[model samples]
Target chain A: MRGFLVLRVVAKLLMPFMLLFALYVQFHGDFSPGGGFQAGVIFAATVIFYALIFGLPAARQLVPEALVETMVALGVLVYAGVGVAGLLLGGNYLDYFVLAHSPVHGQERGIFWVEVGVAITVSGVMLKIFYMFAGRQRSAEDE
Target chain B: MAALTLGIALQRNLYAVVVLSGVYSFLMATALVALDAVDVAMTEASVGAGVSTVLLLGALYLCGGEEAKPLTRPWLPLVIALVIAGALVYGTLGLPAFSDPMAPIHTHVVPRYLHDALKETGVPNVVTAVLASYRGYDTLGETTVVFTAGAGVIALLRRIRRRKDGEQEAP
Candidate 1:
């Protein structure tokens, strides 16, 4: 793959656009067809493409294992924490009505944050699966 | 799509199977779009075609690319599969017709969601409102499951690295 100049150039050109589309899907989900789940997979796909073109080590270096692990936990915490916030604000568990000054605004704010959390967790899961499979091959070759 | 599935089943090469699976997923996504399930289509395209294909290819690399031969006869499994298919077809006879306005699902809670979703969630997208606010608890549970799966894979794979290092140190 390294010897293929055309492949390298095409990958370099495509990576940024792929990432941008993922972010678009993540943010525009409220108004559009995509949501956290789709956005997260798209995000992971960009990184996987990088791994395919430049090798797994390069992709791992770009997104470290520790960071990916932390993302998995942090996303869940963010989601749970939002529910707790609702409860503390004199609303039912997972209620979005009390998240802001007005009920409608609160619902909007809460849904946005929850979707963000979902996107994070989904991407982390995807990257973790990729890392496990790709790392196994590398380790086997080394042994 | 049926042709692709047949090709996948007939192919002995795991690599071809994985590739055909991706193609099947893409076709399914197109079918979902045709049914006006755009969100589901997007998910299918991404997770099924993108992530699953890469993961399968990686697995093929770690294992062998050729599928193993089955030791037993296939007739019994084929009979069981046909019976299950027949049962499923029989079961569909009891289901409401497609797009039936008076169906149980349409008459149950959908009206409220459709009428009140905008006022309730402040989100124009009813799908997102339903998924994030109406069914927040279920979404939370799904996120937890994803997190747990990731953690489980890390635990399983990282242990091998630790054990290998410990063996080297002991020697």
Candidate 2:
């Protein structure tokens, strides 16, 4: 992988835009046809692209397995945490009306945070699955 | 589309099957967009065409790239598929036409989602507003389900290898 100079250079040139597109999909989801799920897949696809062009170790160094695993849970926690926050803010469970001063703003805010959580979890899971398949037998076989 | 799908089902080469499936997914996404379901279109394109192909290739790397030869004819599967397709088409006969505004669900449930979604959630996409705010509990459950699925796979697949130097997965 390191020897594929053209691939390495092309991947380097492409990754930044991939990352930016993922972000665009994430934030514009509320207005556009995409939301967290699609955005997360795109984001994970970008990371997986990098791993394909570079080595898995390089990608793993960039995003530790530990962090990815944590992200898998943290997303759910964040989603549920928002619901709890709604409750603590004097509304029912998962209520967005109490999340901010105005109910509309609260709804928007809640959706935003929830989308973020979803994005994090989905991307993490996708990467973890890729890593699990690529890592274990791979390293042993490589050496 | 049928040609691509037939190529996928009939191809003995696992790599060609994967590639054909990717093309099938892209076509499916285009069809979804034509149906005015852009959200679903995006998901189908990204998840189906992109990552899953790579994942399948990775799996092929471990196992042999060739699919195993079947000992018998695949007639039973063909019959089953035809039966299921017949049943599905029969079922669809009773349903409203595609994108029919007068359809039951459209008349019953979708109006409010389309009308009040923006005013209620300040989100322009009715689908997002419905998923995130109106059906918030379901979305939360969906997220939890995704997390649980990931955890389940990790539990099943993660092997603690005993290296010579006592190396380990990071905590």
Candidate 3:
């Protein structure tokens, strides 16, 4: 596989486009038929594709396990923080109306941040699962 | 689709089953698109077809490529499945027709959500407004679940790596 020139070349060429599409899906979600979940999976798929072509170690180097774990926790914190911000601002839990000067702008801003949180958590979870399963088999074979 | 299901059911090869499952997910996504659930279709296509297939293939690498023979007789499980299927079919008989305007859902808070979503939330996508604004708590919970799952996997797998490192150090 390391010597497979065609696969290496094609995967390198396609990875950037896949990532760009994932970002597009993430940002355009409010207007389109995609959102955090779909975008997260697309992002994870790009990493998985990279892992397939370049090997697990390379993928691990690109996104270490510690960072992935942080992403998972950070995303939840971001989401909960937004809710607490609402509470601190004299609104109910998870309330977005009080997030800005205008209720509508506040809602939009809250939703956008919430979607970002969801995307990060979803991608982290997907990558964690992939790394777990893939790493387990490799370690098992080593023994 | 029926043929694909039959082929999946009849096949003993786990690899073939994984491939067929991916195909089935793609078909399900197509069906969702036809039903005007584009968001759900996108999710199905990405999670079901892309990620799930890769995960299953990774799992298959660790497990046997072929499914093992069942230890017990199949008739009792078959009867249970048929009974549940029959009950599900019977339950559907009491449901409203497709796109029934007078349905309970259509008559409920959905109408309000649809009418005032844009005005109140300033989000043009009603689904987004409802999911992120109206039901923000639920979305937060869902994100927490994803976080917990990742944490749980790390807890489970990290111990193995720690043990391996200890073993190497001892040797």
Order the candidates by lDDT, highest first.
Answer: 1, 3, 2
Model 1 achieves a DockQ score of: 0.87
Write model 1 residue lDDT over A32-121, tens digit each, in one string.
998888888899899989989999989999999888888888888889989999999999989989999999999999999999899899
lDDT against the true structure, per candidate, is 0.92, 0.89, 0.90
- In CAPRI terms, where does candidate 2 land? medium
What is the lDDT for A29 in model 3? 81
Best candidate (score: lDDT): 1
Q: Which pairs clash inside model 1?
A: none
Candidate 3: which docking quality band? medium
> In candidate 3, residue B140 scores what lDDT?
86
Better of 2 and 3 by TM-score: 3
Worst 10 residues of 1 chain B by lDDT: B162-171
* Retained true contacts (fraction), each candidate: 0.91, 0.79, 0.80
What CAPRI class is candidate 1? high
True contacts kept of 3: 0.80
What is the DockQ for all candidates, taken in turn? 0.87, 0.75, 0.78
lDDT string for model 2 (B1-171, tens) is: 988877877899999998999999999999999989999999999999999999888888777778899999999998999999999999999999977878899788788888889998999988899988999899999988889888887886654444323665545
lDDT of 2 at B148: 85
Query: Mind giving the per-residue lDDT tens digits that candidate 3 earns over B119-162?
Result: 88888878778888898889888888888888888888788688
